[model samples]
Target: MNGEDELEELDEESLHDSEALPAERPNPLIIAASVTARGGVLWLPVAGLLALSGKKKAAGRALTAAAVAMPIGHLVSLVVHRPRPQAANIPARQALPEHPDSSSFPSKHAVTAAAFGTATALEDRKAAILVTPLVLLVAYSRLRTRVHWPTDVLGGLVIGALVALAQAGIGRSARARATACRLFAMVRPVLSDHSCPSSVSE
Candidate 1:
């Protein structure tokens, strides 16, 4: 064959070889982020750590946030029927094998991440700073994996933040009530003693 024909043949073979090659795998970091974002993976460990460190209130808040966020997310998902990227015929790189058979309106992972992260931050800023990246990664991973739309993730964040704020407010109110009760108890005995002597003298 002439040089031109030989070059053309080599080019065709190279093209075919490239096409036969397997699709590139997703980044390891992205995979790790996706896995860590699982409902019980990241937040559960965090809560456990907080409890072990004697930060019981912070731990309780974290657990409460997750518990509340997950159910709310599911309830919203049930109300809004949105398809995942792949199901909607949009191009997506699914990193995880398990495709959840549920509406993808709001990512539960994002909700849990935001709720847990926000609650923890409210209780401990330093700890929040440490976990902030993981929380962001979890949110990003949902998009990167194409399991959730951007709006879904955004909605999840907003809902999670609201839940955290509500929980924080409740905690503060409970503490305030407990303090008031303690103060009233402390003064009640003094008032009773004075009134009892006055009545006896009368």
Candidate 2:
């Protein structure tokens, strides 16, 4: 081919290649999910609403669960040095431009989601049903955004659930103790009255 012909051909090929490459467009759904997955974003408002509605126990549990889950997730990430999906050369898109350069195993977002969901469930099943979809979406977003592996999400879920369960168990135990004390207090007064009357009659 002549020089001009060759130049034309190269230009055409470049145009074709550029057209073939897909542009990286921002996904609004993924972005929304990622934002919603934040521990504070989901839990804080829910807790506040619950408190305003006089559901203090549910609010307390949800906040406590998220608080407890965060440290545990951080501790696990420290112990397990796993790379994020993108760092591992996996084909994935990150929803956020900035992310922590820490171990990807056991996603903190997932942990917080699970902990808040489970604690809410323990307090109010109906509220949990509404919250469950959000939790699942948060977990899926972590994977979709290439921030966490499936195992990381799973491990976080397990940790969160366990923490919520432990908290619920403790609450139940405390309630049982309180109930026993209340019953004893009521019965003790009755017994004292009977004994005094009997002693006076004797």
Candidate 3:
């Protein structure tokens, strides 16, 4: 948490990005880390909160936002289907597979992480800090997996950002609606039979 630590972290990240990996080791580790980080975000504590909480409305907002964003992301992935780094003329140190699948556009890992990350962050601020690193790992995994170019990771990042933004918007709108309902609740007795307007849609 010191300036030196921050500088060291920054330098490490730069090395990760800029260094030409030996074409075998980095990708696998990146891919594995991506899975572990993302799994941690989606499976346990956050999922448990969604399952156990009585705050159905808030949890529902988060889950619904995730449900909406994920497919749209993959759909966008298909639309922008760019070739893998190995497929383009860029020479990798690793040999290309004989049957290379052509879809290397938006990374599914990134999109998945984004969708879940946005949901968790919107649901609870503390969760976002934990989720943030997964986003980076998933983005990096595309390269480490040898399934995508760095630019593909970049594109996936944009897609993830947009997805997160959209979900966050939904969360915002839900909050606004809840606020309106509370406001209405205050005024309901004055004219509307003391009825608290429901915020069920959010």
Candidate 4:
């Protein structure tokens, strides 16, 4: 009935309310997806496999697009300064294993994955089929883990696709071929150590 007694009762009610909220559980698939999105680890093997399969040109183009997308997306994120879902007080079912130090406007993971998938698809439709699903999964994972908002992934997708389109268009040009030749020449010493096919130069 007194003020102290009333305050104690209120505190108990608040504690009960807080305890009623469900705790977030971790999903194995989501954990794997989150890890895959980090540092372009998933795409490295994909690119390496393409190179090993003698589609080095295609691999190069895809990787080039991914490389381009990463910095562009990061710059955009810096300008946008949009907080991630958690930072914005938007609840995520799960959190990243290690939080990123960057802003989360456009998901770099989505951008790189999308760019890689789109570029690979441009070179080989069959490989795209495999890559596209993985890209989508990475996008979905960002949402599921609450690292990015829907629009963040969408922005990344758009940028990535555009970069891939540009790379594919350039890949068809004589200038790009010349550039590739020059690039290959610069790395010839490294290539000499490997069994690079003669056709890759041609």
Q: Give the winner by lDDT.
A: 4
Q: Write the per-residue lDDT of candidate 3 for residues 38-130, one digit (tens) a residue.
A: 423453444556557554444554456555555666687678766654423323323333334657666655666666666667666765676
TM-score of each: 0.76, 0.74, 0.61, 0.69
* Clashing residue pairs for model 2: none
Q: Comparing 2 and 3 by lDDT, which wins?
A: 2
Which 10 consecutive residues of model 1 have the lowest summed lDDT? 14-23
lDDT of 1 by residue, 81-123 (tens): 9876553232234457666869977888888888988998899
Q: For model 4, how many clashes? A: 0
Model 3 whole-model lDDT (C-alpha atoms):
0.56
Residue 92, model 3: Cα distance from true site in angstroms:
9.1
For each candidate, what is the lDDT?
0.73, 0.73, 0.56, 0.73
lDDT, model 4: 0.73
* Candidate 3 residue 90 C-alpha distance from true site, Å: 12
Between candidates 1 and 4, which one is better according to TM-score?
1
- Candidates sorted by TM-score, best first: 1, 2, 4, 3
TM-score of model 2 (CA atoms): 0.74
